[model samples]
Target: MTGQGSEGTFCLVLHSHLPWLAHHGAWPVGEEWLYQAWAHSYLPVVDLLRRFADEGREDVLTLGVTPVLAAQLDDPYCLRGLHDWLGNWQLRAHGAARGLPDLAAREHRASRWALEEFETRWRHGFSPLLRSLVDSRVVELLGGPAAHPFQPLLDERLRAFALRTGLDDTQRRIGTRPEGIWAPECAYAPGMEAGYAAAGVRRFVVDGPSLRGQTWAGRTVGDSDVVCFGRDLEVSYRVWSPKVGYPGDPAYRDFHTYDHPSGLKPSRVTGVHVDPRDKKPYDPDLAAAAVRRHAEDFVDVVVARLRSLRERHGRALVVAAYDTELYGHWWHEGPAWLEAVLRALPEAGVRVTTLRGAVEAGHVAGPVEIPPSSWGAGKDWHTWHGPQVSDIVHGNAEVQRELLELDLSGPVRDPVADQAVREALLSLSSDWAFMVTKDSAADYARYRAKVHADRFAELAALCRTGRGSTGRGHERAAELRRVDGPFGHLDARSL
Candidate 1:
């Protein structure tokens, strides 16, 4: 398996990320957002991997767990919240089981199975899942920046720190260093290659457009030895295109509709007249059947592509990547679809492999310089820092600069400086801008930006004047420093 040459090699990289959701907010948005995904996606996905391993099947999966999300997943508060959320799942199962047909009863049973799996398999911290997969040689873990910053928007030097910090965090948890990483949002910008090479990451995933002038597949970035795997557009768009994709299928559960009427989802995506409260009950059986069909169809596409590639290159590889949340969170049936796909792949002659496995086998054909691009609309940075998000992004960048410039050459020694920097960086995440532009949580976006900006002001004043300032931003930053303390021996000299 380690030898060179690609013969039926397919890498599936799932990018798992959720903004620093801890203690943010809840109901329609916030921390519960984290728990809901935990109950629905993360837990089940972990269970799937465990089940595969227990069955003695080494189905390699390359997974990227961002540090910010990992911190929440392992936090005490998140743990408790997840337990309560699963209990709610049990409640939903009871509701489905009562006054229901036999088929419905079976669906309810499946729901119970999912809930139980969350409780039993993922009751412990998530690190165990990564550990089991790496130890059993079924997965090659990938890691990236702690808070998942958009690298180009950040100072160049911080990029390395973020990558190294993320890798270190993963090693501490899984007891093995990761050789691969998923750049946040599949985001790439010019000059970020050196950061990857410095972190010992030999391979990372990029979007399809990065290979504009060259053939798609695994290619090198710039002068670095770090291999860059370009996502296969034909395969990826099949499941997640904006226009016509599996998620848009009428039979699938409606992501926009919330079942306020029946307290359960019971309608197809009509693309109109869909109110959250009026949806129907969630029917797992119907969804599961759909998953099986989709899984088979997907495998068919991969098989055909693999054959075509072999004919041209004598052997070929295809890499299909997707956001981890796309499964159980967005598609609802995603986890089942994934499980079915994994189970069906080998039988269909398509081998499931990780990015590391492909590169380890020398599947990379050549080196190429990747242009600056993101997987956002038009394959640009608009989603994170474009025109719509520029105002807040600039606001954030300005504050970050102020905090970084405050004589942080060495650990802030002063608790106030540390807290101010910590708060500022967390607020610097691109997610707030996205939420504002997408109207997902506009008010929350405003609150986060103001809070961070104010906190940064206060910290800067304290560092210079040795006393908390009276201005609104300055005072706020000072109070935050008092409460959160400091950045903990952080040195700003590198910046």
Candidate 2:
């Protein structure tokens, strides 16, 4: 163990991810999901990071970009779609100008900024922007399974393949392989750290409950060299509590209430219990004041939490992890709050850094055994494995069983065989199960899972019968390639 420093560390881990949404439906939960996040969350957040970088901030946070989301961000089709979406945003704002001029002006300002940023920096792809951040040490990047599969439920061989392929894909895209990962759903099972170790992962994140409330420092899982950092729920929940949090403050913009004509949020939260129709028009000045207030409050919370933890644990670390989309996507003023919080933390005397930086700064507390867990409800695996999603669970197993059977017979050789593997991997995405269980677009989730599973079955049948090379299979494979390809680095023969 290394010497503990006086200042406790704080890690801000922002998980940036969305399931593959390319060529999916447009509204409610498809391409629209991707575009809204890109415009409101991703754009503003990255802009904040670039600003911080320009000011010479290093290791400001850790960013986890799942391979599937990374692929979509860099896809040509997605790029074109985002551009069109931004253009439409501007058009909608223009149309709203007469009736709701004040709201329309705000919409215009926001949409115009989005359009300008997209044209100047993002027209080509996401890799360059994210790669720049990684190269410059603005943030530590994390790689997860290619499709963000729930690693604990996956077959050992398939999980390993997905992980390695994911790491390699990130390396190929951004020129630096990640040593840390935001485990899918922050899910874990006994001995899973070894799988991470085998893939050269040095660290991973899980919910604090998995650490049994011992979250003041990183703990090595059962003496493995790899470390597990649990999110400090005390600190994290201060900003994200489902019951009450900073984002729900009356002064912030209401995420749920929208000026439908302009596709813009036009009202302050006003009150959590206030009707959306009765909410007050958003006041930028008031929201800006709230951002400052919350930033200072959060700094106090972090300092107090760290001090209290260090009193017991000695030179502890406080990790506050949140979904990256919560910023600007779910909360209209979130990016600003994030910026204010990040800038204020250090000034309040906390040692703010990335997860990797925390490790290097000797923020570890020796080894411990983590239990089977996830960040979901009950801090267990139920979110992805609940009775509600039992069909999905069973369905995934059937597909994996079929995949293993194919592999056992012989090395699969056709490109269509690889597509079968690809579709199977897609079918196993944790998003579908999570969505279904959460009742957020359950029908779409089921439809997506079934489509991928069906396609996998058809392709696998062709491969098993040795009909995959040249013919209808090839044409079908081409369609798959054009329609849903994300991981160019994956090959079934290799997996």
Candidate 3:
């Protein structure tokens, strides 16, 4: 893991995703998850990147913002809800002041500061902030299927449609298509490489097992030139292991702790048995101190590993990847930790690069056929679209197939065809796969599947009725406008 020359280039991949939760669920559960994360993680992280760039730092970050999540973030309902939630957060801080113990005074003060920060920088929205970062070239925006559907579990007939549709959606948001992808959950299966190649995806991240017997560095999938970079699991898993990681730290915010009395989360994760009320509010000053310690430790590990790698492989680039949500959403102090780490990396002599930059810098190894693999347990797709998730998935996939066959392949062109296509793609997102795997809000997963499918079904119905569209297909534009998200105007004509 350590090599002087190889350590010079390190690539980090951040997968940012959340199932469609907007206008869907209650606080501390669904949409609240989105707003809380927006206030804590996404907004802060994007702001951090923007600040980094504003300071003339060309630090390259490979960020994957799944279209499904993006759609929700950019949705009118979510924007409005987020602003309201920010206001409520302020009220909660103010309300807490009356009952605060002297020992808890600092906690109340920190919450007030957190609220103020949210109001000033994030009250408006994060779409503009994210766009600015991408526009500034401070981070490489990666894309995947509109809803990040695990492709392998999907019926073969629907595979191409999902890939191409997602590609178009990515292009819509970022003003260009992404050649690189953060395959939803790093889930992959044999023969899926063809879909990626057809969609113009030149590179994607995978787990070490996907390399089969190959090394953890980058390699090609099948005979296609598309590069597959395997994650350096040893380093990557240290930040967010389900059993133990930074999130488990005593000083970090507890993800599972809920104040039974107030319905608000106040405690930091102390241990598995700690009571919610017994826990303490997050203190940023303490958390920031921890970040400094962790940053130094992480850098030390990277440097030593690089030195060791130099002894073995002469030069070997280490690629560490993790879910982007871990920063602020799960680990309350994640944003601070991230900032400290990035700022210290250069001083430690480690050059951070985007996934694409690594490919271009010749850090990638020679071509090799990758085996079917994912970052899931045992590098399998079980975490998403496995048996637990497949029963519901197969049913929805059938609807997808019928919809694509009827709506996409027709020669009777319609303006709403692209919107129809986008809806179809979002319906098949890999997010449902995750829900089924985790069993978190299975009903919501079913509803999301139904929502997209229902939209597609509507298009299918209109097409079958022979209700001819207006000039240039503008007559049915209202219907099209309704379906114009998760990637507006898919241009399915290419399919």
Candidate 4:
């Protein structure tokens, strides 16, 4: 929608999340996902922001971290595991020296930097680094549901609990509470704004179609003061679209063409349909040049979009949001391009600000109703609730129902009940259904969903027995707690 005012602002939002993977499986999925995203995406992205902050940039972007993922980043087990993984990565790079010398050199250098960064700065855990960023106003952090659950498909009571708990978890870690959220999956249903307002969230994001493609400015939801910022897909997809995106450029590293010996990617994209073995060796100089060109092109696009929108509205705020992992994790050159774009935007006269800054600057286009929607395929709920995930959809519903019915009220809070809540939340994570529907690590996604579901049932049944946690039940709860722990401050009674 055309928002109010003549001044134009551009807001870049990145949703950073992974399901609770602390004690879950490793390799292929689980903890591996966490470490990869952390090293390749979070580490570099945050570093770039910190560097720019040194040069005095404020409100660089809005980054959202789901509470489940936040807990993993701070967990002792995860911290220790990441240290080991970096060491292992160094070994893997060394092992590649004989097989692919050039790639080995690059990998070794990167691995060394990663390990050093982890040891010196990240060893303390995520909160300190994130807290500093928040304190300095380097970036705006957006909080979300505790488990990154699909909010539109969630029970209202659970939804509110998750949001409040998630925001509280963020406050505990970063010191300042988030006023906005990168709504889980950018998913929403009618009246959800009321729940957000109830949880003290002043703003959230949704897909463009949710606002009927009027994405030029923020719009208030229903009668609530909570504002909804629709992602401008036209701007976001220039760098993220699967087919035509800048990441697919031939000069960039090919994500799929890996040198199996060392588990490192060494080839340039060459062509979308080219055989992996036929791709050319990746050249950093070439990729850097492409980054510069694409970054300039992006700036030009934003300028043109803002110029077009300015003709209709007094103020234009062009929003472009993407998953945080997309940068270094999936697209090797993404972080460089991002830095380039952020640096160029201001020089091009575009106000680079966060979604909050947009609201504060009066970007509201007035109240509008949002329907059931998501950033998922077709801009609807099918990814989490579609026919392909019918089993998972049904399983999650049953888990939520049982948890709601269970009596967790007691004078002394029971770890059993607390874990049951955690398990239930983990089981309901949208990642499982999404993976299953998309066929990306479907087995791992299913296994995790079932594991959490089973844990929830076991814990819930023990709580229902009305016997104080003891013997086998006590031992079982402890075991599960050790593995699935996240959101330590969560109160099951919040249900």
Candidate 5:
């Protein structure tokens, strides 16, 4: 155990991710999903971190930017689409000025601010913006497998390939390789730590129950020196949870119940059972108060939790992990609350650090064998493999089996074969299965999975027949590339 001061260490791990949504549909569930999250969550959070960096604060938190999400953010198609989306947001705010003047005014200001930030900081790509943060030492970035595959179900060879490729892509974009990863969904299986260590990943996260609720310090995986930090759900749930959390406050802007006139959320969460039509107009002042109260309450929770954990363990560490999109995107006042908490933790004598910082400071325990688990429902793998999503599971399994059998070596190697692997990996993303299980956007998820599967099958067939470079094969490859071309330098030989 490591010695600590009066206050214990607190690490905030935010997983920022989204499925590949570039050339897909736009309105209710497609590219719009990417744009909204970009405008609401990424921009504000980055701004907050930059402010802290300027104030000479290092290791504000640990941020996990999945390779697939990074690819979309750095894609030209998505960048142009996001730019137009911001413009439309401003127009919508202007259109609502008459009916909901107060809401419209606030939205207009927000839209303009988002537009300016996107144009200035994110114009080229997220690479420069994220690289700046890493270079400034404000946050330790976590990289994950390409396409965010649930590694437990993946073939061992393909898993290693995905991890290496994803890490290489991260290094290419961000100018540095990540030493830690936010395992997709915090899912883990025995012996996966050896693969992480081989890829130079020194640390990753798992759910609290994976450690049997003892998460005071990072645990070594199996006999490997790699560290696994468990999420402190007690502290994390205070900010956001299933039934009751700060986001459910009556004063906060309601995420659902959108106003049809201007496509803006103009109402507050009146009550648990309040009708959309009966909800009152959103009051910024009231929401601001809620953010303040929630932020202070969260700080107290962390301080108290750390102090309590210290009683049992001499030196303690508390890790609170959450989806970065929760702030500003789902819960409108989340970014403000996050900023408040980040600032208040230090003032209250809590040591705010990153997972890497804690590990380097020797705040880690001995090896422990972790069972198969994820931070999903029931703290198990059922969400991705349950009866509800059996089809997706079987389909992904077939794709992976076919992918491992493909021959991409020697003189017969085809470029189309490389694209086939890419498509297969995209199809294997856990998002499709997760969406189907959650019923959030089942149809879209199914459609995306089918599209990628069809593309992979078609390309693989062409390669198998030695016609991958022929006329029809070339045309099909071109079409697929035009639609999904994030990893341009992908080489099948790597696999």
Candidate 6:
């Protein structure tokens, strides 16, 4: 049964997430990651949605904002830091204009526009802007576990607590509880459906291989009623694949190989092996033409895929899931391509709906037994639990064991216990292991993991001594609170 407006339904799922990075390093790694994504991806995407809303469009797409990300976006420290980062970006653009006029002009324009947008709309916090979209019913927001943990590997009790707390945080901030979630790394274990059900999550996305390549409709997981939607890799890979994605086009701005004089990338990906100094200069008009070309190509592919699926399944649902940061942050031309695609899809007779909208439109199937899986490198859990990351895995397990063993049921509540739990959760983030395995930012990832683990160890020792509420233990706990205070409402007693 297809929705009344189209032959088939297409759901675009953008998972927006990053690990907690506040008060950490700033340049090259930590808060810079947050600011860059905010300026490039979040701002432009929100603008596109608002433009659609002004034209009376609804059910645009599914957006997953993890609680950890939300906490950072809403934090006062991050807000101030973002404001300053945008200013610095503008300064760099101006400095680049002396040597590279063409590239510097474009960068200057972008920086100024981003600064104006941030100051006018996002100056206060992301909540007001995000809440407006939710209130308008233009997008279905998906929530996930706090800290973006790989839930399949977590302890059962901790898993439940994280899910519930994440939902609670989203509700408090977004003014609505999410009905769906973008599970961290799209990872799944056999019994997670029950935990999702308990947390009031009605549906989630999984990798296509997890469903054995038959990803036409959302399937109920095992005996539970929670629906699992498998991504259509065929369509998604057309836009972004390992071998050839639109971002690698010669006309697009080069992501690597920055100019030494100005620290701005002035070259194009003229040739895969060409030296940065020998590459062709970037031209906005050339990239714009490519964006339109690629957008049309993507629309054509989606339409053809939907028609084929419709012929086979009568009424099929095609879900294309992607990392939200890919749009403008990674690809540079991504946001433009996205805007073009969203506008072109409906015009091409494909109904662009959110995951929840697809379900409500009757595009669902019977239950299927989902195996333990993740959307990792090999379409399995190896990226996170592989031999290369075995040390991280073992460290995580030891920390969890100690944190759980701590007794917080006594009369005098040990504040360090709460801090230890916070540190433990932060340490358990899957980014560390993934980064180590990928060798991208491996050192920073390992440093972050070790820092949290050490903090947890210090606090755990204080808790064991029963001196957590006074002396050096109290000072350390207070310091930790200052460092990791996003979940002030978190109570160790509940754990």
Report the Cα RMSD per candidate. Answer: 4.2, 2.4, 3.8, 2.5, 2.0, 1.9
Off by over 4 Å in 6: 1-4, 410-414
The sequence of per-residue lDDT tens digits that candidate 1 reaches over residues 51-134 is 888888664688888877776776666777877866665566556554544434544665677667766766677877779888
lDDT of 1 at 424: 67
Better lDDT candidate (1, 2): 2
Instruction: Tell how far residue 373 is off in model 3, in angstroms.
Output: 1.4
Error of 6 at 327 (Å): 0.9
> In candidate 2, what are the lDDT values of residues 7-82, reduced to their tens digit?
5788999998899899989998899999999999999999999998999889999999999999999999999999
Tens-digit lDDT track of model 4 for 112-228: 999988888898898999888888887899998888999888889888888888999999888888999989889998999999998889999998889998998899999999999
Error of 4 at 133 (Å): 0.6
**Top-scoring candidate (lDDT):** 5
RMSD of 1: 4.2
Question: Ten consecutive residues with minimal summed lDDT in candidate 1?
Answer: 483-492
TM-score each candidate.
0.87, 0.97, 0.87, 0.97, 0.98, 0.97
Which is the leading candidate under TM-score? 5
Clashing pairs in 2: none
**Each prediction's whole-model lDDT (CA):** 0.71, 0.90, 0.70, 0.88, 0.90, 0.88
Residue 197, candidate 2: C-alpha displacement in angstroms: 0.9
Model 2 lDDT, full chain set: 0.90
What value of lDDT does candidate 4 attain over all alpha carbons?
0.88
Off by over 4 Å in 4: 1-7
Superposition error at 473 for model 6 (Å): 2.9
Q: Report clashes for each candidate as comma-separated counts.
A: 15, 0, 11, 7, 0, 0
